[model samples]
Target: MTTTRAHGEAARDDGRSAGRPSGRMLASYAAGSVGTGAFSTLPGLVLAYYLTDSIGVAAAVATVLVLVPKVIDVLAYPLIGALSDRASHRTGYRTG
Candidate 1:
């Protein structure tokens, strides 16, 4: 004979994926994204100000300095994503 269990009892059988992300995970992702954005933008903002005013560099040059690095950073994103996928697979987690 087979027995059936309620939803709560079934959830207790497996430790993962009872539902969507918890509040803690959502908060952590939000904070981490903000931190990373600050780290990336702070230097560019300072340099743009210094180059256009204190250093007497042209606005074009300042823009180039600010934008080129960002462009390069964008280009690397896909490769980094692929590398992360490979690492996950190596660690025995499927991308699916």
Candidate 2:
């Protein structure tokens, strides 16, 4: 049996062209993930420790402050996608 490379896809050792990742795609994903993680996780970790040890704020209040922002992410993602869809842009690119 034999396989062949398809257009745009990279040819692999098996002779079939497997999908290749675009550098922009990877970079965008990496940047977004880092930003989101920093926004959501870093504050929670830092504030929780600060409130529990240094500030003397109640644990419950500290937990709520750290958590509510993260919970809002559930709605924020779809809202952002909806906004993006409605937005008019000069540049267009393939999603997949």
Candidate 3:
């Protein structure tokens, strides 16, 4: 014989009690995204201009300076992904 459970009971059986985010959690996540997006994007947009115009750096040099960090980020991401995968395998949690 088969038995059926309510929606909440079925979610709890799999250990994810809070199946969907609460309103407060969703609001907090939205606020965090706005703040983090502004902080991350503003510098990339302004840094090269500031270096070339205000600091009197040559345009080519400023471009290279701005680009080097991006290159490092490209290289580092794969390594970080691999590390996270390994950690997840060991701990059963996908956290670095």
- Using TM-score, give the best candidate's number: 1
CA deviation > 4 Å runs, candidate 2: 1-24, 88-96
Tell me each candidate's TM-score. 0.68, 0.54, 0.59
lDDT comparison, 1 vs 3, better candidate: 1
Task: Give the alpha carbon lDDT tens digit for every residue of 1-96 in model 3.
Answer: 333576534323333344466677779989999998799768976998899889999999998998988889889989999998888778886321
Off by over 4 Å in 3: 1-38
By descending TM-score, how would the candidates be arranged? Answer: 1, 3, 2
| Alpha carbon lDDT at 16, candidate 3 | 33
What is residue 14's positional error in candidate 2, in angstroms? 14
Residue range with the least summed lDDT across 10 consecutive positions in model 3: 8-17
Give all candidates' CA lDDT scores.
0.82, 0.76, 0.78
Off by over 4 Å in 1: 1-23, 93-96
Candidate 2: lDDT of 10?
Answer: 50
Tens-digit lDDT track of model 2 for 1-96: 543567655544644344566677689999999998888687679989999889898999998988888788887989997777666353453353
